[model samples]
Each structure stands twice: as C-alpha cells, then as structure tokens.
Target: MAAAPRWRERLFALYFLSHIPITLLIDLQPLLPAGLQPPALTELLQWYAASFRDPLMLQPPEWFKTFVYCEAFLQLPFFPVAFYAFLKGGCKWIRTPAIIYSTHVATTLLPILAHILCHDFSKAELGGPRTQRERLLLLSVYLPYLLIPLLLLFTMLCNPHYSHTEKRKRK
Candidate 1:
C-alpha cells in the first residue's frame, strides 16, 4: 500500500481540471438555443464545424440529440467522481463510475468515428474537410475524445486495488 506516484496524481489532476471548462464549452453550450447561446460560443461552434468544411450545422437527429443530452448531464455527476478518484488517488467506489464514463465515451465516439471513416461521401450527413489543414485540425479536436477516456480507463486499471480485485475473483 505505497503512495501513488507523483506523476500519476499530476496526470489525474490535469484530466480532472480540464473537464470543468470542457463541460461548459463542449457539453453544455450546444444545449442552448441560438437566442440564448453566447455569440462567442456560437462562433466557436461555427469554427469547429467549419474546420470539417461543413458549411451548415444541420440539426442532429432527435435520438442523437437525446444521446447528447444524456452525455451532457452525465458529465455533472462524473466530474466529482473523476476528480476524487484521480486527483485524490482513491480507488474505492471508483470502478463503477469509471466504467460507466468510459463506456459512454466509447459508445458515443465509435459511431461518429465510424461514420467519419467509413461512410460514402455522397450519402453522409457529415463530410470530411476538403483541405489537409482542416482535416488535421479536425483530428486535433477529435483525437482527445478518442484518447482521454481511454487513457483514464487505463489509469484506473493500473490501480493495485483493481488488480487485487481481479486476482481475488480468480481464486
């Protein structure tokens, strides 16, 4: 039962601290109507969409909107759980929230990535950027959605208590 390494705690702190602004910028802002949304927020959203060479921000499907809403609301509860688990280096009661959050990130990211990678250009609702620079920018924005949760999940799995739990199940 040695103390967690300094680097691990620091990494967790970075992850936890980032979620606050991201929750507001990415998760919460789009939930607002055009009238209520801040002009800066609107411009930021437009820039992101445009980076993909997408000229229009067409309405997402109702089911997709519901899914986004669920993702947005879930961030509220998860923020505290993630902060305590990672920043405090505590494993107790963390596995469930970590699993749920990781699962949500995985499930949501997969379809979008698939559509971006696999869909026919003629038929798709979203299209890839026309220029290499925009494509790179798009990847820069999206790569985090793929990497961070996965890295966090890997960090959670690295806990000795989690390893012990697995070991105990084998006995």
Candidate 2:
C-alpha cells in the first residue's frame, strides 16, 4: 500500500509548488537576443537588472520588492514543514536549530546578493554604476551560499555522518 503524505509533507509540497508563480514572473522578465548571452551572462541584460553598487549595504531593482514579497510568502509556511519533517523523517540529525536557522538565513540573504549581481537585468534602478570593489564582494559571497546547501544535502543523503539517534521502542 502506498503511504499518504502527512500534513507537514503536504504543506512543504504546497510551498514548493507555489514557487511556480515566482518562477513565472522571474522567467518572464525581458531577455537579450541570443547574441548577447555570452557577455550578459548575469541578470543585467534584461530590461530589469541586478547590480552590486553597494557591498556593505546592498540594494536591488524594484521588481525585487515583489520578488522578495513572493519569496517570503513562500517561506512563511515552509519553516515549520522543514522543522516537522526533520523530526518525523528520520533525518533528525540534520535538524538542529542552528542548521534550521542557517537555512532561513541563507534563503533570505541569497536574493539580495543575486539581485545585486544581476542588477543589469533588473527593470528598476537600484544605484550607480558598478565598481570593481562591489564586484569583488559579490563574487566572493556568491559560490559559498550556492554550494553549502548542496553539500549539506549530499551529506544528509550519501554519508550517514550527520545522522540523528532515534531509537524505536519495542512493544
């Protein structure tokens, strides 16, 4: 017999599904002709752009305001699903509050960075022209945020090093 999705699982599924609208909006942004792809590898080529004019203090294009709102709306219901999933799924080892908090932090911060880096494509104006210093800052932060989750996820799945101890009681 197939197992039905638990309430928490159902909620997470919904949260993941809801990302479609945001994806649609993001994908719908104006794009460059095929020839421009190589030079405008970043998000700046579009009518809307994301740039890193400020390092310590980052800003994004106007469309980002709507994007961020959609992101938060997506996340609001997701945290608990992750929490409950951790407890219930036998992956409790990876469910530390710190890890959970980091997940939240990562999700929240990446967009700001992504927006800054891709500002050229952003439809709205954020700030002045990009500088090397701002570029360096964006470059450094980029890969770590992108990589860590994959590392954590891979560890959770492949190696059992991060496993939690949950003993089932005997009848």
Best by lDDT: 1
- lDDT values of the candidates? 0.64, 0.45
Against the correct fold, how does model 1 do in TM-score?
0.74
Deviation (Å) of 55 in candidate 1: 7.3
- Every model: Cα RMSD to truth: 4.1, 12.8
Tens digits of lDDT, candidate 1, 1-171? 444565765676677678777667755655678668777877887776756654223345465566567767776667766777777775657766776787688677776665445444454456555455655655566668768778667756675654345435564
Instruction: Provide the TM-score for each candidate, comma-separated.
Output: 0.74, 0.35
Task: Identify the leading candidate in terms of TM-score.
Answer: 1
Which regions of candidate 1 are displaced past 4 Å? 1-6, 52-58, 120-128, 131-136, 166-171
lDDT of 2 by residue, 1-171 (tens): 222225433443343354354334442232223454444433442333334344222243455455445445554455455545543544443345425534654665577566556655224345533655766655664455445444444444344434444679999
